[model samples]
Target: MPGYSPPVSMLPSALQTRVDAVEDPVVKQLIKDIVAFYDTETPEANAQDIIKDAEVYRGLGMILPERRRADIAIKQDRLVVIVKDKVIAQGDWEMYDLVACLPVPDRPKPTWNVVIANSTGKDPASSIVLTLTDVAADKFIENAKPVSIRQALLDSLRPYVKEVYDEPVLHVTVHQGSREGVLSFLHRYIIFGYRKPLTILPLSQISNLSYTVVTRLTFNIVVVLTSGEKHEFSMISHDSYEAINQWVTDRYLEDLSLAEERRAKKQRAGPSELEAAAEEASQLPEAEDDSDEEEAEFSEESDSESGGEEEEESDNAGSEAEESDS
Candidate 1:
């Protein structure tokens, strides 16, 4: 019944106390086993790397499809998820995929989503989704973006700014069909949040998009999808409406330009190269499903003092906008 105590000892004082309170010997050992998996693995070293060199982007977030909230940090190429100050999940850039700029639940301003797969298991059962504000999210995206494609993406997006475009999200209510939700948009995606899970719409799917000022206080956005599906949203924001509308027009045009680049590239590659590329793409493993979450609320969260309750260390925590559920 003694099993392994080494892993338990390796845990920080606060988490060790939690493990000590467990009454059952088997339960205690099982918890240690999970810890051993992390300690003996690469994540401990990853954390050490953060401590020594890299800066960390840390925040709180929920796991998708499972809906478990935890403390998350990203440093260098590593990301860790902690509950009650105990690390429950951890992985590096190479082990799992990363996605950024996805929509998020109504919580705080300058919010964005950072999703990385839970990499402890071989089969990849779940993902850690950190809903981060701009400071943390920006740091994450800077590292997560692949060097190879970063230049290509900028080249594809027309009128690309040397610096990424910035717009402070003004939380406003929008209606879709029978549902009313908070509307948020980025350069590439639309996220609608309310009582249900956040529904995301990617700009790439839209064939045409238009916005109209209905009254002095309200406006409507009409979207036509590449599939010919049409959707509309009505939102009221006195301060940010025109700015948001203009931003959307600019981004939508950029999206179309990027799409055209893809076509041009394919044409230059010829039929045989397209077939070969399509076949190669098909062999890649599929990403995990991220919808079907419950209600999530955000709060104004500032960074905790450097390191733990006492120590200072680099906290760590980007990728792309996910496609629409509608």
Candidate 2:
């Protein structure tokens, strides 16, 4: 009777049964954590509170469900999706490339599809998709006036914008012949992929970036590499094209300004102190040769003086000899 408490009759019969049947230590601990999070004395007695609390626990990876239903929730500024008690996808709102409420013909209500880039992976360019219920999707969108998918993306991106360098702001799907990939701009690199990076272009290595609006529905992105090779990504949406264009233009200008600053600094500083010292060292042999030349001239003068004195002494001896002969 110590651990046993009267079950609340307000909870859905199925959910209450699931909670009562939980025997796994992990699940029990998760329930405790969830109860502590809400600071409620008897969360099990409140069906609605327990269900909402379960979402937070699920998002934090404290619990895993048995089925593959969308358990979407926001925790610690991240949008997380848990499926079968496993974290299927998670990211900051700014990292989300697309989020839309699409109608499912077979289902009674519309389903939300959220696409986000993996920012911390080796293939940071890849994308993950999460499907959520209407309530979860509404929470994910946050209350924005005249709600639209593009508006939500812009709202998320606004927080990351800075005075000097903007956030990695571009999100577009790329199509190359038979292959397709998702493209995203990060703080320092441009990544392309769906699950792994197909291509990673650093900001420094990006030589030329441009985009074209082919039509109201079609857009194309073109990139010119330092090697002079051109790559074109075609068949993009107009809204996506505009977003990419703004991001690329801003980043390109910033990169150019930074490059110019570096060049000017290099010119002003000239060579490094070590390099200048090495140059001076290389000219030391010339100074040594000059010193040698001076030494040689001094030796030549001394030799001539010595030879004159010898000649004078020889003349004096010859005069003495002539007198003796007289």
Candidate 3:
């Protein structure tokens, strides 16, 4: 029977020997097709290319084994996941809700997974999970420093800078726990959490912010709100504490200057034109009410006088009648 055959020159000597030994025509044809499919060179044919072809096989009602391998890279300001030069996913540091390296069952190496919260949905089911290989995981951790990561997040919120006093951010801290929580920053405000803000405290609302030295090596930060509420955060590094203090001092000076400028401007302008107009309009109603009360009192007095004259006329007529009768 005529059957598909691979070029003997294309295979190694051992493979070519085996193909020659196979007498069954159908079996030989199947082996040829498999070898050709793998060896056929397409554009940048790599593992991803293999998967794409495998998908095509499935579409044609053929069963093919599924395989996946992706590389994650920190490219400048964004984290990118690539599969054979194709970007499968890319996101800024702000897109991530949580990132950690975790071990998989029966796998010797740990896998890195990023949990991304959906902007439109708040439920856990709406979140997306991305897995990265070992090499990519190392690069991610190296670049994901508190300062750099926070800077990326702040860059996205540049529009709110003016309202937030546009003050420089001094320090950033990540909570210490098995499940690492969101990143917190000391900016014009103490903003915490990811995509959705978990806690936001205006600088003005903070009555006192200090750190207690727990030991020579570590410390805990204490934040006192204006309402006498205190929040204590432990496991702060010495360097972070120093940065926080410097930021607090700088913010204090900035606040003082801003207050003085506002006071001077108010004095120079006196009362606003709108304010003066509103005050004059308020007095008009009072004047109108007083005039109405005076008119009512005058009418009451006139009625009393008219009634007295009528009574006096009636008494005079009765006396005249009595005299005439006599």
CA lDDT of every candidate? 0.51, 0.51, 0.47
At residue 269, give the lDDT of candidate 1.
77
- Scored by lDDT, model 1 comes in at 0.51
Across 1-326, the per-residue lDDT of candidate 3 in tens digits comes to 01122355457799899988999999987887776454333244443433331111011100001123544344333333344554334334344323221222234664322333322222333223334334421233333334432233323233322232222254354453332333344344554332222344556666667767577866777778767977666666676766777777777667764466557878998888899998889888443358888999999999999999999999999999999999
TM-score each candidate. Answer: 0.37, 0.33, 0.29
Worst 10 residues of 1 by lDDT: 313-322
lDDT of 1 by residue, 1-326 (tens): 11222335457799989998999999987897676565534454444532344333333456453455554444444545555445565544554432433444455664554434312222233344444444423333235444322222222221322223233243457787778866666556554543344454566666777776677877777877767877787765566667776867678567766568668888987779688899999999998654433212111122243225334222221012222322
What lDDT score goes with residue 233 in model 1? Answer: 79
Best by lDDT: 1
> How should the candidates be ordered by TM-score, best one leading?
1, 2, 3
Q: Give the poorly placed runs of model 1, Cα more than 4 Å off.
A: 1-69, 73-80, 84-171, 177-180, 194-196, 211-217, 229-231, 238-240, 256-326
lDDT of 2 by residue, 23-113 (tens): 8978865664553333323333332333343223222111112224444544334444554443444444445333322222234765433
